[model samples]
Target: MASAAFEDIAETFEFLDDWEDRYRHVIELGKAMPPLDPAFKVPATKVDGCASQVWLRPVVSGQGPAAVFDFQGDSDAMIVRGLIAILHALYAGLTLAQVGQVDAGFELGRLGLNEHLSAQRSNGVRAMVERIRSVAAV
Candidate 1:
């Protein structure tokens, strides 16, 4: 498997050792992302369980078992937006089979997100993961 894009996040977290600094890093990641165009921000793409308004749109390509997908994600909250970027980093280049086989929540703990996020935020993240996985399952 290709190294996960968020592994850089884990390494960066390892050095900080403080949730506040870690959270600042998360916000920075969100700040660095290109804003999602308003046209793509529609009801059909909304993620249902996030506390913040969130959207997910995926473009799938290739054929048969070799199919791969790339996703676009956005959230109104800065932290949630950072989480969206993390999800994109982890998932964007993967084949559907690869996406289906991965454990998304485990990666959260690995990235220090599981420790820092509140229960609501964690659940929101899980919902986002499910949204991506549901798309891959199809």
Candidate 2:
């Protein structure tokens, strides 16, 4: 699923010649993401440094070495939601170690999302990276 997601994004970027179309494709991807539960919406789970309200929750099952992350974002910003979906699809089911190994910057570049993102979105991405790293470190 992860590989397919990556391929789809790549294909979409390649097929679209305009940024507007690319942005629409990204929003479509975000729309495909499952809706997060309302109850999980809380200040504790809210991610800082984001231009919009973003929430991240980790689900650790038993004594598993990896943790699954479920994320939610509320914003009119399609790109941000798309970014979150990409992250979720790539790392949701992985272990902490695997999560830490992800080359986020490189992956974003590959998706052609890194350079175009706003500063606030970039900071949010960084914050997410830090949170993942912290969890992995433990």
Candidate 3:
């Protein structure tokens, strides 16, 4: 899944000459995300302060120290899904501490996403980071 996500991002970056194309590419990627089960849908899982309805579920494996997140959302919020994919790449297989150490906001800037995003979208990204931090703290 991580590899596929990376490949998607790489392909999008390579194919798109402008932000509009990139956004369309992102929307296509979002379409590829498997739908979340209805059972996991809950208010507690909903990310607060987002323009869209974002759901995040954490799975803590007994064999590992890290928590893996299963994310889903309503609305055709492509950039949000892409943002989630980025987070998955950074912290999916890491220990909780290691995941916590990652500077997601900085990484977003480094990846050139922060520069392209609107204030609301940027705030949503920050909210995601805060949510991840809270989950890691548990």
Score residue 104 of candidate 2 by CA lDDT. Answer: 74
Ranking of all predicted structures according to TM-score, beginning with the best and ending with the worst: 1, 2, 3
Ten contiguous residues minimizing lDDT sum, candidate 2: 67-76
Residue pairs clashing, model 3? none
lDDT of 3 at 109: 58
Q: Tens digit of lDDT per residue, candidate 3, span 25-45?
A: 666666666656767668777
Clashing pairs in 1: none
Q: List the residue pairs that clash in candidate 2.
A: 66-95
Superposed model 2: Cα runs more than 4 Å off:
1-4, 62-76
lDDT of each: 0.84, 0.68, 0.64
- Give lDDT: candidate 3, residue 60: 53
Off by over 4 Å in 3: 1-15, 63-76
Q: How far is candidate 1 from the true structure (C-alpha RMSD, Å)?
A: 1.4
- Estimated TM-score for each candidate: 0.93, 0.81, 0.76
lDDT computed for candidate 2: 0.68
